[model samples]
Target: MTDTALVVGGTRFIGRHTVSDLLANGYDVGMLNRGNHENPFADDGRVTHIEGDRTDERDLRAAKLSTEPDVVIDCVAYHPRDVETAVDVFGDVDGYVYVSSGSSYAEEAIPKREGETPLRPCTPEQATDESGETYGNRKAEGDRVAFAAAEAGVNAMAVRPCVVYGPHDYTERLDYWIDRVLTHDRVVVPGDGQNLWHRAYVEDVASALRTVAERGEPGAAYNVGDRRALTLAETVETVAEAAGTECEAVPASADALAAGGLDPDDFPLYREYPHLLDTCALAALGWESTPVDEAMARTVADHRESDRDGNEWDPGRDAEERVLGVKETL
Candidate 1:
């Protein structure tokens, strides 16, 4: 059981949390990445960090030989070219937990229920060579290649989280709205305030990834999202309440937000999907969501406490004090 768990691109927001969870849960963790950001586990000597590029074949091959992990939890993979690189490097590994996305679901055309349809089924070389337009498409294509390789040989499982939010999130997606509602008392939305959004805490997502690495059945796909699908307005209100303050949240037009450089990136808040996810399957595996109210409060607290010298989130500065992205002003 001490065999190492290789985390590819494990320096990102979700990757950090998952690495922590893996370490805490008794796995010998090893991170493989380009050494871009500050090392999240700088203090911990229990795990090894292999600085390399997953997209690069030589780098990945060297990492595979060095770590020789039992499980490979991919945290960054976009193109099939990346998948090709990974499989070429690690010909045989225990479990391959691909960090795929729930966006693989074709929610625009069909309501995505678990097993409702095979997720991003294998496509021909010409047909699947390109992707990554939307969150769903990129994730779907990535998952397609990963699952196909797993089918060939390798214990592979995928988890599609609705919207992952926690400390140090890349893209600063959730913090934007949460900070706006809690601090600025202004919530922006497009078209209708009623358009819904779904989100999951980073810790919960991390734990789910760990669980899959530990006990996930091979080639299985699990949706790790909360059932609490709240509309944008309601989510704002809930965030405000969790912030322990009564504030005004004025919904600005989409044009205003876009002009203000508030264009939604990773988690588009105003996307219209009645049901973002049915995460019952993840829960069935004994993976639970940190309560809505609790997670919300923690997010708010972390945001507030993250204020360092009143300049909490300037990317130009170098510091591990905020080893994550902060879009406090939204």
Candidate 2:
């Protein structure tokens, strides 16, 4: 029997890659989304695009998405309500894989291990806030809800991935550095650029999701990311090398960047503390991730090929350049 999988938000980024992996693995795939984005898999006959709002129970029922799928890969279930609606609608499936964020973990020791620290759960009000200050907590609540559904007979697991980069990255987090390195002689490094960062390749994340769908334990959460962590300076160097460009790293204080109108939140890797995640559980599942250098190369190449329209630069680049210029003056 051919396994059938339903991918929520399947037209972009990790979700897009996951759908491609499912199709390549011989799984008959169905995608649920609002149909506003361009469909990359429109020509693939094996994929059935189910246009519906994931939040609306009526849309889900109308699309018949709840009926007996072998697996459900939810890439956008960020809130507790999203998880609850999925469990309430999809009742039972052989496997349910939730694409969660590593941010769901409360601040813990470096190289944070799964199950070592309690997750921070957000209140309903906090989850609905638009400022995104409670994003991690809200995702934690979603994970909790998924686990609760597992207790109610839904076989579900959550995969927490650190910063995901590579092809089809709409956020342009990695691309920000790539563009700057390619276009500028000097790039600003926030906070000494020594904070260790961990990220996962989008393809690796997709593979991890497929692995969880196939063999993951119910109610389990796995942290999936690169085996090694790189500092922000090292990351910029990697991108520069990949792009075959030479650029100097100019150290800038976070306060200085903020003074120049660059939000600290905008630069995720430039943090005061290291954001490392231990992926031993994922490795123990017999999965290996792409090396950071190789993934960076592929990401830079892809960005150059597909995103060369020159609009991917950060909107605050002028402010950042002004800050760097002032530091040069000093």
Candidate 3:
């Protein structure tokens, strides 16, 4: 009945939510990690904690031996070799789901789809380089590895999430926007602020992992994202509403930002073109995203309760004010 689930790297972000999702769905959950982060479910009798590194195949094998999990959700397979090793160790499990990224898609399209969209190709050197430049290539290679494992009779599948945001988001991308809305009257958004970047709420992503583990076809890849996407302007509005505040979304062009010694890339979650993923495949599995407003509410509430101001993504309000001045003059 697929009653047992083991999450690899379940101490942070998406993985942490995945553990909760599995627990809520009546599966006995086990989390295997390097012990770098505290286990949020340590006291829960339904959860078991295994101290290990995902990079080590020995640790994976040991965890499997101890847990005998029916399904495994891997959230930290960053390299092709990592996926290869995991599939080899967990080949006999009922299901093995790998967390991939939208960056794996090689081409840009309005809505990138599974199977139709080509994935970034990785050379052996890029597969192990561990640099940001090769992240997509490496993830694409990992997706390929999972496909090959599925071909070899392993119930392995891949789920690609574009950008994930919610509670416990360490990336601080969306946090940047939430912080801006809470702390400022004028939020400087790059470009026209209609730039669309598909984002999945963390809980929806968690449910996707569980749903894929239960219902996904072997060797198939599915895209995970919000059913209803929002433009950057709409995103800011959503954040404002969530914070129960009013703010002006000041759209700053690249030239305006450059006038203030800032590049468009300095702003987090800014994309030149609309980045959307076709999530129909995931929806067919009977999964749905949390409503945008509801999702933002939980996210903002968590932000208010936490100390993450996301200042790391902020280029200082003074620089933004300079950009605003340039915009006003133009």
Computed on alpha carbons, the lDDT of every model, listed in order, comes to 0.68, 0.83, 0.93
lDDT of 2: 0.83
Cα distance off (Å), candidate 2, residue 180: 0.5
Residues 238-307, candidate 3, lDDT per residue (tens digit)?
Answer: 9999889998898888888998898888888988888999999999999999998999999999999988
Query: CA shift at 230, candidate 1, in angstroms?
Result: 2.3
**Clash pairs detected, candidate 1:** 103-136, 168-324
Best by lDDT: 3
Candidate 1 vs candidate 3: the lDDT winner is 3
* lDDT sort, best first: 3, 2, 1
Q: Which candidate is the best by TM-score?
A: 3
**Which regions of candidate 3 deviate over 4 angstroms?**
none
TM-scores of the models, in the given order? Answer: 0.80, 0.90, 0.98
Candidate 1 residues 1-330, lDDT tens each?
Answer: 476888897776888988988888888888998887999787788778898878788887777778788888888876656766676566577777778777777644333566665555435552345544544556676666666777788677788887777676655556666655554544444445676656778899999987887787766778876556667777777778887776544444445444444433213455744546677677777888888777877777777676422223221222211111122334
Better model by TM-score, 1 or 3? Answer: 3
Pairs in clash, predicted candidate 3: none
